[model samples]
Target: MPKIVDREERRREVVEAVFRVVARGGIQQATLQNVAAEAGLAVGSVRHYFESHPELLTAAAREMVHRVEARVRAQRERLGPDDDPHDVAEEIAGQFLPLDAARADETAVWLEFAVAARTDPALGPIAVELHDGLRTVAGRLLHRLGVDDPVATEHLAAVLDGLALNAALHPDRLRPDAVRAVLRRHLAQLPGGR
Candidate 1:
C-alpha cells in the first residue's frame, strides 16, 4: 500500500520552503521551481498544492502572519499567572522585532514578500491582511496596557513598526537596549505610569 500524505502538513512544508528561499535569495529568486527544490518535492507536487506562483506566495505570506500569532500566543501562555499583563504585552510586541536569529530570518522573508506585494496583485491582499493583523495585535496590547486613546495607540503601533523595521535593517544603529528604552519611555507616558 502507498503511504498517505497529510495535505495540510505538506502545505506547511511548502510555505516554509517559500520562506527559506525568500530569506536566502529574495522574492525574485523564490520561484516555484526553487521552492519545490527547497522543499524536496517535485515541481508537479508543488503545483498540485498551488496552481500558480502568486497563489503560493500569497499563501506563504499569510502563513507568516499565522506563524507570528502562534508564537506570541505561545509566549503569552508561558507567562506565570501572577505575571503582569502589561509586561507580557511588551514582550509580545518585542517578538515582532528582529532581535535574534529566528526573528531576523522571519523579518527578512517578510520584507522580501512585502516588496513583491507592491507589484503582485494576488499577494497584495495577503500583505494587507498581515499588516492589519499586526496593527490589531498592537492596538489590543496598548489598550490592555491602559492606553485609552485610540489615536495614540495607533500612532504608537506605527512607531513600533517603524522602529522594528529600521532596527532590523541597521542592527548597530538601533540596539535592543535602545528599542527597549523607547518602549519603556512610551509606557511611562501612559495614563498611570510607574
Candidate 2:
C-alpha cells in the first residue's frame, strides 16, 4: 500500500519548520537539512513540498505575511470599524510587536529571516516583495483614514514600520498607548485630522 499525503498541510508543516529553524539558529543555519530535522521529517519529505532551499525561504516569507494578515483581519473583525482610533491603531500595530510568546517567536523568526535576506541572493526578492506588500497595506489604511498628505501613503507606511521596529526593540519606551498617541499626533498634524 502507498501512503497518502495532504499536500497543503504538509507544505504548511514545512513552512513552520522553516520558522522554527530560523528562531532557533537564524536563517544562516536554516538549511534544508536543519529544516527537515526541525520539521521531524526526511529531507526528501520536506523537498517534496519545496523544490529547493530558495523555495522554502520564499515560502516562509509568504507564510509570515499570511500570519500577519490573518491576525490583522481577525483583530479588525473583532474591533469592527467603530472602535476608537487609538484602539484600532494599537491592535493593528500590536500584531507586529512581540507582546506575547507567540508574537515573540514570530518576531525572532522574522528578524532572522530578514537578516538572511540581506545577504542571501535567493531570499532577497522574497523580502522585497513582502516589504512592498506590507507597505501597500499600510498605505491603503492611511488613505482610508484620510491621510492623503504630501508624502502620501509611503510616509504612512514608513511611520508604521518605524514604530513597529521601535516597539519590538524597546517595548518599555513606547507602550501600547504611547504607540496610539504617536499615531494620533501624526493624524492631528495632518491638515484636518483634528
Candidate 3:
C-alpha cells in the first residue's frame, strides 16, 4: 500500500509555503528546496507538482491572483443593495490592504512578486495581469457607484496601491485604521462621494 495524496490540497500547501518563503526573504529565496522545507515536504515532492522553479513561482503567483479575485468577488456578493459608497469602498478595497497578520503576509508576498516580476520575464506577464486586474476592479467599483470619470478610477486605484505599499513598508505610520480612513478620505474627495 502507498500513501494517497490530495493533489490540489498539497499543491495549495506548496503555494502557501512559497508565500511564506517570499514573505520572509524575497522571491529569490523561494526556490524548490526552500519551499519544500517551508512546506515540510521533500524537494522531489514539490517538483512532482511544479516540475521546475519558474513553474512553481508562476503557479504560486497565479494562485495569489485567484485568491485575490475570489476575495473581491466575495466582497461584492456580500454587499447589500443599500450599502453606502464609503462602506462599499472600504469593504472591497479592504481585501487588498495589509490590515492584520494574514493580510500583511499576503501583501508582503504580493509586493515581492511584483518587484521580482519587473526583471523576471517569466513573471512579467502575470504581474501585468495582476496590475491590470486590480485597476479594472477599481474602475468597475467606481462605475457602480456612478463615477464615470477615468481619473476617478485612477484616483481610487492609486490610493489603494499607495496604501498597500506604505502599510507594508511603514506599518507603524499607516496602521490598519489609518488605511481605512485614508481610503474613505480619498472617496470623499471625489464628486458626489459624500
Candidate 4:
C-alpha cells in the first residue's frame, strides 16, 4: 500500500528543507536533489509538489515571508495600546531582526536569494514583491506611530535590514541583545519614537 501525505504539510516540509540547504551551503546548493536529500525524500517527491527548481525556490521565498508575517501578527497581538512608543516600535520592528539561530538562517537565505534574484528572471519578481512588502509594513508601522516624516520609515527599515545582515553574517560580533539595544537606540532618535 502507498503512504498518505498531507499536501500542505509536505510542501511546508519541503520549504523548510530548502531553507536548511540554503543556510548550510548558500542558495546555489538548494537544488532539487540536494533539497530532496535534506528533506529525506526522493527528487520525484519534491517534483510532485513543485514543477521546477525555480518553482521550488519561489515557494521557499514565499514561505519565508509568510513565516515572518505570522510572527509580526503575533507580536502585534501582544502589544498593549498604551505601551511606550519606543517599546511599541521595537516590538513591531524586531520582527525583522534575526534574534536567534532560526532567524539568522532565515536572514541568510533572504540575503542569498536577494542577490541571486538580481539576474534570475524567475526570482526577480518574488524579490521585488518581498522588498515592496517590507516597505509597506515599515510605512504602516511608522505611520501608525504618528511618524509623518517619510524618511523615518526608510530609516527604520534600513536600520533593521543592516542589523539583520550584520547579525546573520557575524553572529559572534552582534548578539541578539545587542541588536535589540541598537534598534531601540535608533528608534529613540525618531521624531515620534520614545
Which one is best on TM-score?
3
Per-model clash counts, in order, read: 0, 0, 0, 0
**lDDT at 121, model 4:** 91
Lowest summed lDDT across 10 adjacent residues in model 1 is found at 185-194
Report lDDT (CA) for all predictions.
0.82, 0.74, 0.89, 0.87
TM-score of each: 0.87, 0.78, 0.96, 0.95
Best candidate (score: lDDT)? 3
Cα lDDT of candidate 3 equals: 0.89
Rank list by lDDT: 3, 4, 1, 2
Clashing pairs in 2: none
Per residue, candidate 4 scores C-alpha lDDT tens digits across 51-90 of 9999999999888888888988898788877877567778
Candidate 3 matches the true fold with a TM-score of 0.96
Q: What TM value does model 2 have?
A: 0.78
Candidate 3, 103: how far from true, in Å? 1.5
**Model 4: runs farther than 4 Å from truth?**
none
Provide the RMSD of all predictions against the true structure, rounded to 1 decimal. 2.1, 3.1, 1.1, 1.3
Task: Give the C-alpha miss distance for residue 145 in model 3, angstroms.
Answer: 2.2
lDDT of 2: 0.74
